[model samples]
Target: MTASREIRLAARPVGEPAPQHFELVETTVPEPEEGQIVVRNTWMSVDPYMRERMDDVESYLPPFQLGAPMDGSAVGEVVASRSAGVPVGATVVHFLGWREYAVMDAAAATVVDTALAPAEAYLGALGTTGLTAYAALTEVAPVRQGDVVLVSAAAGAVGSIAGQLARKLGATRVIGSAGGPLKARKLVEEFGYDAAIDYRAGSLAAQLAEAAPDGVDVYVDHVGGDHLVAAIDALRHGGRIALVGAISTYNATSPVPGPSNLFSLAAKDANLRGMLINSYFHLFPEWIGKAAGWLADGSLHTELTVAEGIAQAPAAFLDMMRGGNVGKMLVRL
Candidate 1:
């Protein structure tokens, strides 16, 4: 038997999950079945989307059950295996995170090549984060040459990549939004954005207009609500908007209303499309190929906010929710 430490949902949060909402418990893991393997997780991801799963509400994915081990993206080395294909010592990526060790089916664990990038990259830019950015820019709001792009939550894992990808995909200029001046500066200095708006400073509408006087041709929305309204107000005729996330309302207790200026979609002859990454998994092969090359050639860069130890996962998650992290937040075991 293997003793594993795991984080469980102790209680459903009302708003802004605190450390009390989670509990760390120890459990013994039995040997895996004939087609399963035991992975000792080295790195795990803590994301904003996990907050929505804490609520007992209907959404694209099911909510986390109370007092049970919660899961997300994790990268680990297989310590024990019952299948010959996934032998011990193979590094794998799986959905069983928030725990130090996990027993996963062979089919569910993907063997990623560590030679291309570090193991943790699978959880950040080289993994779902990169895929979401690529699909959103290329498909959701295809950027043409000379297009002016705006991205909200522009310092996060997905937004960090989206801003750069937009430029590479042919946007003439890219503007990003972050909560602080430092992050806003990072968008311009590191990720290659034309301008970075400090959303916490003042009016997003006024700032966006100043950033792009001619009007934005594409908007990749991550922080919805006011950001959505602002993007709609700043969009040019025949503009496109990709509704990727709504981090601003993730912790709201009451039902949050969407942008009131939705009518502007018709008035400005613009298009708004929602994105669910699962629907675009088919594009991963192509995205990975291109992203990997870009990364090797120094055209792409990744940032991470690491939380040491499995016990600190809850704190790390809370910090990320409060916009304490500049990029991807990970718990290193």
Candidate 2:
């Protein structure tokens, strides 16, 4: 039997998850069935949404069961395959992450070309991360020509890609919000953002006002709580806002309050809509076609904060939750 190590939820977290909440275990890898494949995982993703799954609550995604292996996006090479379509030596993307190996049905694993980009890219830019930015800007809050765009969590995986996409979609001015001064400066120097807001430095509303003096025409919100309220306060007439995530409230022990300035959106004829990326699966092909080209030509810039080995997966996740990563956070197994 092939031995593998995987991370399991040791306990359901009440507020913030720590190393004690996760336990790494060594176990035998299951053999592939008739239509299943065994993949030796190379790279795994650590995302903010996974933290929500740790809580045993009703949400878009089911809660992670206690004492079982946790799963998310992972890319690996097929070492054993019982399916004809997925042969041995093929690399595929699957959702059986947090482990050194994964055994799943061939249908669940997607075959991607590594020649276009590296395997880890499938976990970030060329995968759901890029799609989230694309769908939000197009389907949810559609950026318009000459519009002023503001993106919160601007140094994160999704928010990092969002700034450039807004400009490409015809937004003349782009503003980004990140936690630190270094990341805030990178938003302009690296990601092509016109203005950067250091959300950690001071008041968000005041900084947002200074960034977009004419008022924001579109807002791609990744950090909810205060960021949502600030965006609403800075909204222009007919402004559009896409609620992608609420990292701010994920670990809240008490019930978080709603935006105080929601009525202002109605007064300004603005639109505020929430988006879940699974609903936008149809845009994958379109996004890959454009994003792949942009990445090759240096238009779409991406960075990675990788933690080596399965043992560090839990620590990597904890750091990412606290905004330690500048871009996509991944674990190399």
Candidate 3:
């Protein structure tokens, strides 16, 4: 019997997940059933959304069960196949956990071309992160030419892509807010953001004003709390706000307050809409086509912070949440 090493949820975390929250175990790899394929995982994605699942609270998605493997986006090579459509040796992406191997139905996996990009890219830039950014910019909040666009968490996987996509969509000014100076520089110099603000320096409101003096027409909010307040204050008349992930308040035990200036929405006639990327799956193919073209032509660049093994997944996740990572955080197994 083939054996696989997996990471299971050892405890429900109250705040940020610690090493104690996970336990490693060895288990026998089950044979592929009627329509299943066994894959040897190569990489796994670590995202902010996983923090929501660690708690028992009700959410858009179910909580992670204790003692069970934690699931996220992953890329793997099919080592054995019992399904007709899936072939052995194919590399596929799936909702597989932090395991060395997984056996899942063929239908649940999306076959990817390893020749196009690295296997790990399927779990990041070329995968969910890319799709999420594309959907937010194109479907959730469409920015027109001459519009001023602002993005929070500007150095992150999704936010970086969103900023580039906004520019590509013909936004006259693309501004970004990041935690540090390096990320701020990256946003402007590398990602084509017209201006970048270092939110950690001082007041976000002041930084926002300097970065987007004309007022932002579209705000892609990735961090909530103070950033949300700043975005509200910086919005132009009839602006649009796309609420993506609220990374700032994710670890807070109490409910984070909404912007005090939410009344600005009424005063400015602005629109604030929450976006859940899964809701726009029907438009994914179109978004992918656009992003793929940009990626091929060097119009879009991807930044990844990769951990070397599955055992480092928890540490990598905690680092990402703490802003230790520059871009997408992933684990290579």
Candidate 4:
């Protein structure tokens, strides 16, 4: 057995999670048995979806059980293996994060090539973060030539990539909405957005109108409250919305109402579709190849905000929830 440090849910968070809600525990991790492998994690991902899981309420994913390690995406090097499929020293990706080490069935881990990009890339652009953007744009709300697209949380891990993908996919104009000026500027200058609206500055609807005078054909929603309503109001005929997240309401203690102008969907013949990345894993191979090419050809640029050490995972998660990170928020161990 080996000693491992892990973060467990001590209590269900009330609003935004606090340090008291998490407990850091050090325990012995048993050796991998038959068909099992042990990984020493190098990088782990903390995303907005995890915030929902912190609550005990039912959602797409089950709530994190109290006194158990919370899991997400983690990439690491296998130090010991009893399975023939995965050998020692192989880099692997699995859903066993919030810890320094993970021991699980070999089938639970997917061996990844570090040479392709890096172990961290698998948790970011080439992994779940990238796949989320790709599937949402291509399948949920595809961009067409001459179409105007708007992405909320534009400077975030998924939104950053989503904006760039829309542009590459033939959107004539792309607009983004972020919280601050720096992130807004980064969206326009770095992420290829034609306009970046500071949702903190004024009315989102007015800003979106000014950004796209002709109205938008595609709306990639990450912040759902007022942003969804704004997109609905600004959508032209046959506009499509990819509802990926509702970060604004993720920590709500009360029921948050949907867009009041949802009637506009019928009025404008628009479509709104929710996206869950787990349901689209089949498209991962295709997306990985395309995203790899984009990365190699300088067409895709990735940014990361790394929080060092396993102990900092809670702080990193909180910072991400507060929109403190511009791109992907990762905990590097």
lDDT of 1 at 33: 95
lDDT-best of 1 and 4: 4
RMSD of 1: 0.8
Per-residue lDDT over 1-333 for candidate 4, one digit per residue giving the tens place of the 0 to 100 score: 789999999999888899998888998889889999999999999999999999888988999999999999999999999999999999999999999999999999999987778789999899989999999889999888999999999999999999999988999899999999999999988988999999999988888888998899999999999999999999999999999999999889989998889997998999999988988999999999999888888889889999999999999999999999988999999
Residue range with the least summed lDDT across 10 consecutive positions in model 1: 117-126
In candidate 2, where is summed lDDT lowest over 10 consecutive residues? 257-266
Q: Candidate 1's residue-wise lDDT over 222-246, tens digit each?
A: 8899999999989999999999989
Q: What C-alpha lDDT, on a 0 to 100 scale, does residue 282 get in candidate 3?
A: 78
Give the C-alpha lDDT of model 2.
0.94
Per-model TM against the reference: 0.98, 0.99, 0.97, 0.99
The residue-by-residue lDDT of candidate 2 on 191-249, one tens digit each, is: 88999999889998899889898899999988898999999989999999999999999
Backbone clash pairs for candidate 4 read none
Better of 1 and 2 by lDDT: 2
| Candidate 3: Cα lDDT at 50 | 90
Candidate structures ordered by lDDT, highest first: 2, 4, 1, 3
In model 2, how large is the Cα lDDT of residue 182?
Answer: 96
Winner on TM-score (1 vs 3): 1
Error of 2 at 247 (Å): 0.3
